[model samples]
Each structure stands twice: as structure tokens, then as C-alpha cells.
Target: MNTADKPNPAQPHSLSANDMNDKLSGDPISNVLLARWIMRTHFEQFAGSSVADIARAYIGVYSNRPTSWQAVLARNHNMDKSEALRAEDDPELVRIPGMRRSKFLIPKSMANMVFGATCLPLLDHEWRLREAELTLEDYLRIRPELIRFASGSPVRLEEIKSFLGLSGSQARACTTVATYNGVLVRAPSPNPWSNRWLYAAAPSELMHSHDALVDHEQLQWELACHYIEQYGPVSVEDLAWWMGISKKLARLFLEKAGAGEIESGLWLGPLQKKTFESWATNVSESSDERVRFLPNWDPLLMGYSPGSRHRSCLGLDQIGAYDHAGNGLPVVLIGSKAVTTWRVTAKGSQRLLSIHLPDDILQKDQQIIQEAAVMWAERIGAIYIP
Candidate 1:
């Protein structure tokens, strides 16, 4: 049976090296190029860079991972330990509840604008759909107590739930509303190595003072252009998923941004001709022997709709790299395709990097892959054991 005839019409065609390279010569194909583009386009800062620079680049790192700061720093080759340490105390960079009520590190200067542009619309839509029993006025009634509890410190969500006598779901909704309205900000996780984030009273003085509002339509247009420029050849569905907006809104934003379709379900912004030409030339000259070990939740994988463009790059088996909860895991990529899963394990005093290849891999390819894994391990300060 032809695999192309599968139910998922977006499934990638299995191509020979030359055929893949031909496609790449005109568009993105390799995850390495995609990952490098993301790093260069969004997070290119010099060593010892200020938190302001970090925030200005791509607004902020999504930071849903444990050791979120470390992950961000690690991806940037220029950042050093001192810079990372200094960034921890930089008042300009503030943590906040953002996209889908998840934690994000945003610039305090643009916090209100970012919230207005992204989170508020989502919150409003969610409220309209659910219409929870707790009202905004009800949340305000207990605001002073909540603020007092979190002032000068961080407080966990559970603590707030207990104090307010709210169920988990209720507390979550209330916090989402509170954060959207600038009543609260996400504090640094007490344990940076864990996913346990805390909430604190919004810095009213700073947040309120900088209510510099941009035209909402203009902001959405700008955002749409940014997404396409960074991850184009993307579809409306991809944009909607990435921006947490509906398909109608995504299409409107793209249209306002002057995006044109490169092909069905793939688009490029108005000024992307030079970029497209450059990438095509680069792809034409590139070697197919490259490999990379990408981290869990890397934007290269997360930037597009998981099963659509992602499946085209890595194939259907890539679904196994995600947990049951839909969280992505670290992966091993040969060219654009994810051929295996990988993880680092602690052994004695050193970290051992293990590569788990798919059973279909030939012995010759396995040897080459093992060698590439060793290189990856060395790059990441791990010991490779094939």
C-alpha cells in the first residue's frame, strides 16, 4: 500500500536525498536550518546581554519548560553563566501569565501592551464561552488579601485556592482573569528546575504607568507578519495555533499583513522574496549528512502545527516523541526527519546521552547516526554511549 494514500493527506512524500535537497533549495526542509533560523531571527544576543535584549527579541521566551531560563540560555551560544545570573535580577525582564495562561518572561516595559495584544482577547473569548460563576468583581473583593499574601514574595496557586475556598478549576479561572487584567504577574518558580511557578501582585506602579496602547488591528498585523517571516510557508492553521487565535482571526491578520500564498496552505509575507531566495540558494548548496539533537519543546518543532508541517518534516512516528499530555520530548534528527528519541541519564558523576533509534534503521545508517550522536553529546557536555 502506498503510504501517501493514508488518511492524513498532509503526510510528507518520502523522497531521495537529491529530491529532498531540490525542495529545500526553494523552501525549508531541514530541522537544523529551521532551528538555526529561529535562534538567529528571534534570540541573537551577544554574551553578557541584558535582560532587556532578551525580552526585546521575540517578545520573550515561552518558558513552559523546567529550567526555562537555562534552556533559553543554552540555545544561545553567546550567553554565559554570568549573563544568565545577571538576567535573573534584571528588573526590566518580568515573568507573567501569558499565551493560554502559561508562564512567559516578558519585558516589563511592554507587559501591558503584550497582555492587551495577546492574552486579553483569549481571556475574553474563554469567558464568553464558559461564563463561570465567579465574576471579576468577586475576584476584586478578595484582591487586597491575595495581594497582601503575595506582596514581597511568591505564593503558589494551591495556597490561593485554599485561602479563597476555591476548587482547582475555579482558582485557575480566577487567576487567568486576574493576570489578564494586570491584577497579578507570574513570579519565578521557587525551584527553577521544577515546573512549579508562583503568582504575585502585579507591579501596579510600573504596569499601570506604561499603558502605552497600540492600535489593536495594527498590533495583530505586526504579529502576523512576525510569525510568517519567522516560520513561513506556514498555513492559517499554523498561525492560529501559534498565536492562540481562531482561524478567522488568523486569516484576517494575515490578510492585513499582506501575506500571499506560496502554495496551498503555505504563505509568505510581502517582503520575504529576498529571504526565500537566500534560503533556496543555501539549501541547494547544503550537505545531507548533517544531524542534530534538539531539546524538548524546541521552537523548530513547536513553531508549526504539530501534525501537519511537522509530520511532513519528521513523519508520522514523530508523534511518539510527545507524551500523552502532548508535551514534546528531546529528539534526534537526521536532516529534516526525526529518526529517533534521545535523553540524558545520570551515571556516576557524568551525564550519559542515550540515542534510541527506530528499528527500521539499517546497520550502516545506525553507525553513522551513532557517530553523529557522539558529536551532539560533546557539544552538549554529555558522554555519548551508543
Candidate 2:
């Protein structure tokens, strides 16, 4: 990912007293309500939905998790392992290089626009830094070769490297540039259950085609708005960090999107303020105890500013749940707060969910946690061993 120097601080937008009371309350927001809103909105927990629905909702989902597809299917469509594996072959969901240069599964309909919006901006700079000798001419020369090779079938990265007879650095630069240029894409993994993937030409015969080049500024504005809508009460720094752009660019996009600052350093998009107000009302009235077993790299955990929203949910004492790189471990979340780090351990033929809570659980809460764990384990073919 390309990093930029921090820009000057944005002047805080003022909120009226009535606006503050209605949208920005003095009490701390419960992580549960926030989590539910994110899961229901971003993850699309509605029944009878499909993989295309998931892709369309978030533009794309980060597919770095071991069972990323299963997690998406289970959360979004309530699919079990066999069902998710079958759905993986659906032609509408296409994998490509996306935000932060990670693998993402997007709807085939929006692949080109997404590439134009997210990947192109960083490609030239990233490639140049990786291989200073590489140039546009080099990319132009290699484009046809890559398309020809990948046209027959999905090709492995090693195969492309060997066929091109280029050094490792050169191969990486070429592949990245090609992907951003829309000539190629990192194809979906053949096995939905695993993360092993192949490189293939973009606009695969199976993909739904659309050739319009989305306006870069418009896309950036939309991206900023979507982030705020899904992860609002955010800051310019939060949007900048999440989009992997400079803070200056983030501020520009936010302003273009007409996002308002609900409080100092806290921003909300035009549509989100009403949503937040409604959620606040629900939070006050509801006393439901919600538990969820979120997979590693789950967007709910990754979507917000790392130290800001993440810290509030996990608390200072549970800082150990995250690694030095800020990748949050799979967690057992009780009412939006991560109570324990959870993992699946193989025990002979059975996979068992191991819960690692930081503090002792009350007997009643433990029973509730156990039930939710078991339900999640069953969906992924695992047993809860809480």
C-alpha cells in the first residue's frame, strides 16, 4: 500500500446543541448496536440473498481469511460449508486486486469501475518504487503477452514469471500494472475452501461486462460517502487510513461528498446522521444480549480507524488481541465488544472452536456464548469447546 505524509488538520465543523443531542449523545455508544448495524448493513445478513448481493453491498470483500467465503456466506446468506462451496463457482462474483493491494471479491458488473477507482491511483507509484527501471513502455510491451497467456485459462503467478523470463521484482510490477490496467485479474481460487488463487485475464468470458470508465473523482467521492455511511462518526484521518490515500485527498473527497462533522473530528455522511439517530433510539430501548463469532480479517473489525473505534470495542486491557501489524485475531464478540480471541483447532476428525477470554465469564453469559459458538461452529463444520 502507498503511504502519504499526513496533511494539515481539517477545521472541525460545528454542530448545534439540538444536532448534538439528536446525533451525538454524551453517553458512549454500545458496541453491540454498532456491530449489528455494520453486520446487517455491510455484511447483508438478510435471508435468501446470494453472493452477488454480498459483492454489491460492500463493493467488495477482503478475501484474506482462511474461510473468507464461508464467513461471507454464513453471515450473509446462512450457507453451510457444502452450500458455500457450491456458491463459490457463481460467475457473478469476480476476484481482483483491490484496496491496500489485497485480494477482494467484487461483483463482476463493477470490476472495471472499482479498478479504475481504487487500484489505478496507486499502481504507477507502487510499481515505480518496486522497480525503478520499469516504465509505461515496458507495461505496454508485456500487456499483450499476459492477455494471450491468461486468455487460454487461468495461469499461476509462477507460470507467468517463468514465461516472461523476468526477475521477481519485474514480474510483480508487470502483474500489478496489468491488473490495474484491467488487462488481467487475480482469478478466484479454484477451491472455495482454500486461499490458493490463479491469475487470469480481466473481463473473463464468464464475467458480466460493462466498459464505462467511472470518473475517478466521482468514484473517490462515492467511496468516501460509502465508508462514512457504513462506518460513520468517523474522522478525516479514519477515511484516509481506510482508503489508503493521503489525508488531504480524503478531506477533499469527504467535502465533495457533503459529509458533515457531527462533533469535533467526527464526520457523518448526509444519509448516515438520520440512521445514527435511529440506531441511538434503538440502543436506548433495547437490552438484548447479542453474541457473534467473527472470522479473522472480518470487515467489522477492519472497517474503522484502528486505534479509535477498535480500541473502544476491545478496551486497553485486551490490546493483546491484535498483532503488531494491527490485524485483529478471530474474536468472540459479546454485544459488540471482543471478550475473547477465538480459534478453530483440529482434534482428530473434528474442528473445535477454542475461546480465549481475557476475564472469567459469568455462568449465564458463558451458556449464551456457548450456544452462539456452537451455532457458528456447526455452519463451518466445527464443534464449540468453550
Candidate 3:
């Protein structure tokens, strides 16, 4: 990779490496970078914490599936899947369409801000209907009936479709519209791995909060700042891609949020500077070598600009851990650098866990990797295959 594409301050793109090295001599830039993100994501920051606690820290937990969300909670709080995966019972959490119009599990308290920022526009202007013959007028007309159907109890999507006497594209379109307008929400799936979910009327409080119609510009700016707080030291391109907005709009939001350029291209929000300093100091003080097994579509892997994703992969840029569509696959991290990839597959009544490692890895490092892999497998009732 070109030096310009790298996020490491030790290997400056313009200034001589020595000059950049000197500039960050007091505290190593690499350490600061890793520490800042780890702290921000709250990776292993606590033990035995509830799902609601961790949900509050992130803007949204990408709901690829219940298993993916479980992996996030398991890794963050150092708990078993049994505990982490069962948080579907948490009343404070709810699923809604978030960035890029994708489903996300977020705190109910954040419903107004997130829905206004990402989904509200879809209600009238940009209906994401796939093939339904329904118009916006039809959607608005059906919204109340859908909410009334879902008001009494959580209803499965299929059940909602049956009651509406809609099928295929029509059912999908109506449900999508209802969800974006906060008339419906995704309830927990019946099983951890199922793609299907129960739909329910959104909480009355959440609906009322959004009905107030917070100023659009203010909501966007607030969401941008929230992203920076959770994933800062980012660029305009990163913010744009993450929020699925135009670069011009992203720049405007950053400016409005008082984001200062921390480097040539990277910026940090004014509100996060103190927290960033504390994280850097704490990381520098401990600086321990720890290993983390990250799950597919983890935010850390998906949070950066395409050009700057090397920040997390470091020497393993060619690992091809992400699919062509930019969705992250499961990975293994030593500190912030993803050194390898891993996966588990069903084998008879058991699951086989496999780790892809460089042939030249040192024996000690190999042993450490094995130990971590074994612990991860046992946590999920899988058998590690060395």
C-alpha cells in the first residue's frame, strides 16, 4: 500500500518518517490510535455488564443477525454467548433502520434522533420500495392500519402481511414504509440465527418524540457528532460513507459540530478531545498485548473510510477480510491490527473453529492465538481445530 493510504503516523506520507516519529515521540501514535478506538468501542472494558449498558455506548449495533450482535456483546463484556445472546429481552433496546437504511439495534432513548437522521426522509420523499405497485399516498393510508394491527402484541412480519392481504413486494413495501415512519419496529427473532423477526408498534413515547419533528439540520449535526464520539479521528469520506450521505453534507456537519483536524486528513470532535487524551494516556500506561476475536460486520471494521481501513489491518492489508460490498468478515485482532481471520462451521453435532494464520508466525504467538481461539470456541460451544 502507498504511504498516503496508511493511517500510521510512524510512516508519514509527506514528512520524513523520522520527522513524524519525532512529532509523536511523547506517546506513540500507533498505540494512541489503537487505544482510542478500543476505549471508544468499550471492548472488554467491563465484565458482567447488561446489554443495555453497551448499547448506550454505540450509535447503533448493526443487526446483521442476532448472532452478530451477540458476538459484539460477548467480546465487549467478556461474557458467554448464553448471556450475551439473550439480551433480546432487554426492554431498553429496539431495532430500527439506521445508517444506509440497514436495520440496527439501538437504545430506545435514541429512537428520535436516529430515525430523524436516517429514516424520516424515506417516509415521504425517498420510499425504498423494491417492486411494490403502491404509491406514497397508499403507504400513508396503510400506515395507521399497520400500527393498529401491531399495537396489541408483537406480530411476526408474515402475520402482518397476511392481515394486510398483501403479498411479496406489496407486503415488503408496506412494512418498510411503516418501519421508517416509526409506525412499526423489528422485535427480536425467535432464534438467534433466523432472518425473520417479529414486528410491533413502536413505543408510544418513541413515536411522540419523533412526531415533534426535531429540526432536520440539527438532528443530522447531532448524529454526526455522536458518530465522532464513538468513532473519531475520521475523515469527511469516512463520515459520508458511514452515514450514507454526500461528502458536502458530511463536511458541513463536521464543521457545525466543531470537528478539528487532528492530522492532515483526520478530524476529531471538540467534545471528544478530553476523552481521547484520557484513553491515550491509559493505553500508554498499560500497553499490554491482548488478542480479540471479532465477529462479522463488527463496527470497528466497517467504521473507517475505504482508503484508510488499513489502520486496523496494518501489516495484513492483503488479508481480504471484507467482501466486495465492503461488509467485514470475522477477524482476529492483536491490539487494533487484524492479523488474521477465523470462522466456525458445523461438523456433525459440533462446530469446527478454524483460524487462518501466517506460516511464519512465531511459536509463542501461535500458542497465544491457539489459547484465545480455544476460549472463544468453548464460549460458543465450538471445538477449535488447530
Candidate 4:
């Protein structure tokens, strides 16, 4: 085996590195290259770092998506010392002290708010009338209420609620920081997917009183980069599917990164060309994919939902748990494919993980797969320790 093929010492690609850089035309901003740039731009901050921890940052910062309390903490705790995953780690979050699970969500209100704050890392949000669904700019241009400062003056929760016509429960949810303890109400008109929240750095991001900070375009750019860089060699359809956005917006954003034309039907932006070299050599090695066990909301699973070009990649197994009606379970990742199924059972001190790998896997693959499973379970603080 080649030295690089040994156990992926470097941080795993946040998305699908297997296919990030491919041929394209007209514009250099092909989905493959853009996704690689996303991963390369962001994960480089934590290169060779723990894949799980890095994933947390990508989901919170780049994706700008709100996460469930359970989801955020689990990812944080996937590493051995989850309790220590964050200074705020707690027993409830961790399966064991310092061991927890993490979930993430990206809300609509915060998306625009994050863009306005200039706190998001890169990319700019171009406000178009159609995009925001507001034909009259001035009508939607109302500024945030004038906030006065006075010594010993505390923030009146009700005042904020009255401004937005929110209920007491909704107010509590907005105040929730790291651990999701409240239910932020969904916006009724412009954005109905509102109210929901995802994970973020507690002290730094979530605490910000404003909603716009969550969906800022820089974060979106970062997310776009993650999808392409990590899951590149992909297509526009994949990004559209993963993000739940329209293809027009996806193409528009990809083009913004200065993509350039390559061959007659191919385009390669500066970043895309750069990505081509990084994984060019790795392709042959990846030709024969392996069996991987991915938790629910896996990047691949979540990326290609309906309205996506590669909609089928996620498969039924990864989504069953996320059914709008009930709690979803983890999925069995087979190479780039989402195949088979799995469930975790906790009998007091021990957690039993039963995985049903794809029937298609060969005996040789199965043997190798079991090894990865042990490694994965132990990594996520599985009580049975594989």
C-alpha cells in the first residue's frame, strides 16, 4: 500500500474528496472544483486535525445551519474525551462524562443576519429583489429597533418578544446558546423554515442577539467550499441537492470564486486547478470504494435530498431517521454510497451497535469493514469500545 493510503493520517475530507475535481464547460465554477475549494479553504484551518472536531466547525461556521442540541453535542463528543469537547460539555450531552453527541441545523433568519454582520469568513450576500422575495426594497428595509443603554438596565425578554410577537417559549429558545433548550419560532412570511436552529460556537456565535449572522453568504461560501473540496469530483446537482437551494443560485455562487475555463468543455478556476493536483493521484486508490458507517445527517446523506441532481446518493437508509414525523437513526456508509442500516442500543453501561452492511459487499470488503467499525465505535466513545 502507498504511504498516503495508510489509515488517512491527514484529516478526512469533510465532504466527498473522491470526486471534487472533474471536467466542466462555459464557466470554471463546476460543482466538483467549488466543493473542493470549500473544503480546502476551511478545513485547512484544522488540517490533519480530528475529522469530527473539524466537522463541527464546518457545520456551525460554514454551513451556518442551526443544529439540535443532541446533534451538536454528539459530534463534539464523537472523539474520546467528549466531555472536554467543549468547555461546556455535560453528562447529558455525553454518553459518558466528556463523551457526547452533536447535531446541527441552519435556520433561514440567521442566514441573512450572518451575512449582514461581516462576521462570516468569506463570500458576500448579494441582495436581489427576487432572492429575498421583496419587490419593494424600502418596505423590507426597516432597521433593527433602536436599543437604548442605561446603567443597571437589563435586557427585557418581553420587549424583544413584543417586537416580534413571539410567545414565552419562543423567547426562551432564542436565548439558548450552545445547548438547544428552546424552540426558536419559524418566520411565517418570508421564511417559514424559520424558528429552527442549528449548532454554533457557544460564546462566539450563538449568543449574538441578532438572527442575520446565521445565514451570511461568507458562511455559505465556506459551506460551498466544504461540499466541493470535501465531496468534489461532483456536480451542480449534488450541491443543489445538499444545500436545498436552487441550481441557479448554486451556479451563481460557484462562478463568484473566479473560476476559469480549461479545455473546450472544461473550466477550472484558480482554486479548481489547484484542487485538481491534490487529489489527482488519489483517484486510482479510491476507484475501489470501501464500506463506511456514517451517522444520520452524514454530509453525503444530507447533501442530495430532493431537487438535487444526484438525489439518489443519500438513499433511504440515511433519511429514515430524519422522517419529518419521527426520530431518525444512523446510517451505514458504503464508500461513497449510503447503503444498509444500523441502530445503537444502550443496555445500562454497554451500547450495542448492530450494523447491517450492504448485501453487495464482497467477503473481502466485509472483513475490512468490520475493522473500520471497531475503529469508528471506539472513536465516538461507544461504551462497548468495539
Candidate whose TM-score is highest: 3
Sort the predicted structures by lDDT, highest score first: 3, 2, 1, 4
Query: Scored by CA lDDT, what does every candidate get?
Result: 0.60, 0.62, 0.67, 0.38
Put the candidates in TM-score order, highest first.
3, 2, 1, 4
Pairwise lDDT winner, candidates 1 and 2: 2
lDDT of 3 at 37: 52
lDDT of 4 at 153: 29
Residue by residue across 254-280, what tens digits does model 1's lDDT show?
787788875456677777746754654
lDDT of 2 by residue, 252-362 (tens): 877887887755576778888777677555443332235656677666666666667545644422635666787756766554345677788767777777776545766
**Every model's TM-score:** 0.69, 0.76, 0.82, 0.48
Query: Candidate 1 — what's its lDDT?
Result: 0.60
Best candidate, lDDT: 3
Query: How big is the positional error of residue 274 in model 2, measured in Å on the Cα after superposition?
Result: 2.4
Query: lDDT by residue for model 3 over 1-386, one digit each (tens)?
Result: 21111123221122234423432454335533544355335564534456666566667777667445554654454555666677756777888887877777788888778878776555453345535777777777778888899898798777878888877678777877777777788876656656677888888878443545467667778889898776777789999998889999999988888887755566778877666666544443332345666677676676776767434434334576787888777777654555688887876677788998888765666677787777777766678999
Model 4 accuracy (lDDT, Cα): 0.38
Off by over 4 Å in 3: 1-49, 123-130, 207-213, 278-286, 309-316, 346-352, 358-364
The local lDDT score (0 to 100) that residue 218 gets in candidate 3 is 78
Error of 1 at 351 (Å): 8.2
> Residue 298's C-alpha lDDT in candidate 1?
55
